[model samples]
Target: MRTAGLALAGFLAAAPAWAEFTTGDALVIGNARYGETVTAFGPDAVQAVARALRLRGQEVEQLANGGAVAMQQALDGFVAAIDEGETPLIVVLSGQFASVDGGPVLRPAGRETSKAAGLSLAAVLEVLAQSPRRAFLVLGEAGEATALEALEIPEGVTVIRGPAAKVAEFAAREMAQPALPLEKSADWYGLALSGHASDGLAVLTHTEVRPPSEAEQAAARDRIALLDETAWQRAVESGAFQAYLDSYPQGLHAEAALQMRDGAPAISPAKAEASLALDATARREIQRSLTQLGHRTGGIDGIFGPGTRGAITAWQRQSGTDPTGYLDAAQVARLAKEAAQSPAPSAPRPRRASNAVSAQEAATWNMARGERGLRAYLGQYPNGAFAARARVKLSNMQRGSGQ
Candidate 1:
């Protein structure tokens, strides 16, 4: 059994009132058998880390002798779970770490010696970058300083990498206690590890976290207000939400921004009203056209309210129009023509063969079904050709529901 130090109790007592402990999830991977060579203590160290995490009230997933396929699946599932909320994440990796093409890659248990077979550290960072919460990554059997130096960890994430034995020793000692505040634990771990030689341990983070100054907090608030305004202005534009997420992945409006970016249409009521230059007949014509194009307009009332605007935006997006949810003379004519050509409601559309379905086509197909289908399509082809449009549709749907 792994001995947990008094770190947990100390953390609870010493941490600031705002820094209370919260439940989190941990992934502990240990591979003792990698082709021919085996780390004597790798498996033991992983168990120790898992025990420590569990003692601190974290949900733990432990994998022993995990191969490439298993590791990939585990990481994908973990990332997806974290993306659903602001859950804290802890990752403990023990095994061979190889440096390839001036970067670091973790080697899972397998006979593959080819560098291409290994998992790149950059790839791991990319998934973690999508997380909107704090993360701690502890690496064992990764003593290569050059590899650690070359890593570009994202902000809000911390990394500790070192020799298997020494890294495991430090983790065991720290976790043996009740619990220590994460920041304090990192500080303590850094100090303890630094006492060893460079070859023994290494620590790196994108930025050193500290309590924000009053001015900094005020600046952040101002930036958030600006972001909110921008989101309102470009709520229908996927690029706008993308830009917001790029700047503040975990911002206050992050969930809202994600909904917009994924395909939720957020038309400004004022903008919609001002842009409505068409007479009632034209508006009804557009609504009927949208209905023919398989979009719902909530009874075609000839008003450019949320329902009509949402339907127009969906149709416009599908038909490769500007998706402004406002129709000009030319666009109205084109829509009328397309509506005339479309099959009646009872007619069956041709279905593409499964193997022949392109990612974009799949996205469009799924989007027509509903939000669940759109989400499934995104899961299948997150970076597919029509992913942007699919996201837009989903965002619009969520926005329609007032999310």
Candidate 2:
């Protein structure tokens, strides 16, 4: 598939002095060089975008027919630019994403001496970690599906790709729409954003064979509505892309789902060690709340530190709240209430009387059982309607045998 192009529009008002935007700080490394192997898109992508966005003060750079080392140089240049306090710098690569042994390799030009150049997702992540700024990526006819699949990015980055044949068309599509709102749109799998870029509303436009039908539009609305917490939870549990996309497509909640999908690592102790810079009022409030919750978390400490996260997680687990370590608004409110309570030591809820199981519940139970056999069945169906009935029937059978 062809990669998409961006056509970001200028803000009506000049961006604040703090904001910086660079659309063409990109290097195109393949095909277009005179002595390189076959070309994918023309070598003029960098120049073209540079000219288009030059008025906006974006410095465009091109690395034509670059080999592996050349590509590294370009990447180093980009890093240097950002280190020097460049606010917004975008990187676009058009070539082949080859699945070399090192993961996803970028096959730059000069294949005669330079072996297939591959840049794996891990490499990309390293680049991102080097700078605090958000970034965007555009892959134009870069790789096959296998290679493309390996190019994962961290949060605040975007990626877009399609079959090599459609790359030019996709690029055109991206150009017409120029830029989509990073915060508002679903995570751009093939695009990256600069952390301090001006907040212009993203707009995309393109001609298509047909407009979506009314039924299709309604179906989409229904699907989006289904992307509630339940659907998201289900997708995470299943770890299936289809299950995920079925609920949330390219919409507002997609990024959140993707974050979950990307498997956010547990916040490391090192990260947690940094004390939250809380004001006096916040510290006092937290301390008071902790005392009320019957926790001796070593005094409120006036900082949201390891002790606070532990307390919050423990409270959440005990209160049937999602045990995600981070406390959001809803969780915070509930935690505040828990702090006020002098409850019995946290324990599991008493079993309910009703034994009636919904079809949905049954389906989940069956899936669990299939995954973990008797253990799964017992764990999920504990004191459930079926389990309650089975217990009673077993007791009756034992009594009859004794008689």
Candidate 3:
């Protein structure tokens, strides 16, 4: 019953709430219970999927371990609200599934394995048929998709079948970065990707969305960072990213501080690492190696803004791989090896030291992954720009995932 229309704003940052939105709803169901036969399924994966969807401004119907009655009601409600346009739509069904009539039906918890007790998969697929271009059906780990060939799935609706965790990952990691090649993505996650837009289009990220009003744009100013605005502006104007960070490590512009300091675009890399969990040092190394090979990264800093990606694209072209401007593990290794054998194209760029602090606050906030990292951040900089936001985020990540 949660109408999460405006929950897409940056959860942790004191940013405006829901400035843009993809029209439509997502139905996410996770059933971990099946009496004594199956071990109790956790809500973690489903919840993660819901959170990611919400962060992307998708309204989600998150149903956890619903019984027969609950399942029917939720499904009916979600299907009832659908419109057959180019609206973003997602449905994640995770749990035990029963195959009857040579088709799959979602089975309720407990000893009931009968088709009468099962929810028809065709009903869900039928709804998906409406907006094939903007729809996705992720068959999560538990209820393995069986005999899908016989199911006459429509052309546009993408179907991804995989573990619940991977499904969550597709939602969290891949959906937003549609440019990331899906083949490698599916291979890494062991997901069987299909459907209309599955070949290339990032259905969720690519789906058309309504932009916010001018008023909403004006309201994007950080209310929490009012005090730090003057100082932050000074730092940026003087190109003293480090200096400003040094002075106000906990300032509102902490993360932005670092990006401005020496990196490329002020792109935050924490939440959107494109599924490649490279740390600052690792990213810098890649940049460094690329530079040695005459690929300019704009700077040797870790941030992979347009410059770095462009360099990557160049290298990919030379190496005879798809020039995605992105890196995979193999590509990363190859780049490193090539760099080692090749001579230094130019001397290592001197690290810029224009005084720094505020950006560190951002680094702490951006780098913190879970409760432990957040707690550690709080312990070090209790009054940092994102401390309070981190606390609230941990308490409730759905709305409080920090910027």
Residue 58, candidate 3: Cα error in Å is: 1.1
Q: Summarize candidate 3's per-residue lDDT along 1-403 as a digit string, tens digits.
A: 1121334445486866543233457787777666544432345656677666655545456655554655675676466445335367788787766667847777765444565666667888888788757777877666455645455577777777776666666766665453465556666788887766445565555332334333322222222132244344445445555544543456555776766566755455321233365766897899888988988765665655555767999999999998867677788899999999998676545322111236776576556765688798888766454444455434433333433
Q: What residue runs in model 1 are displaced by over 4 Å at the alpha carbon?
A: 1-21, 131-133, 142-145, 173-403
Each prediction's number of clashing residue pairs: 24, 43, 16
TM-score, per-candidate, Cα-based: 0.40, 0.36, 0.44
For residues 1-403, could you state the per-residue lDDT of candidate 2 as single tens digits?
Answer: 0011222234663642222222223333333432334555544544454334333333334454454544565565455323233324455567665776666666645432343454444575555544333444556664345676655566555454544334444433444344556433423333433323346534222222222234334422332232232233334444543334322355333555555445556443222221232354665476557556654433333433334446667766877876654555555566667666755545343232222356765665444321144345556667553343233223323333343
Q: What is the lDDT of residue 54 in candidate 1?
A: 54
The models' CA-based lDDT, in order, is 0.54, 0.44, 0.60
Predictions ranked by lDDT, top down? 3, 1, 2
Rank all candidate structures by their TM-score, best first, as comma-separated numbers: 3, 1, 2
| Candidate 2 structure lDDT | 0.44
- Ten-residue region with minimum lDDT total, candidate 3: 218-227
Q: Please identify which of the two predictions, 1 or 3, would achieve the higher lDDT against the true structure.
A: 3
RMSD to true structure for each model, in Å: 20.5, 23.2, 22.1
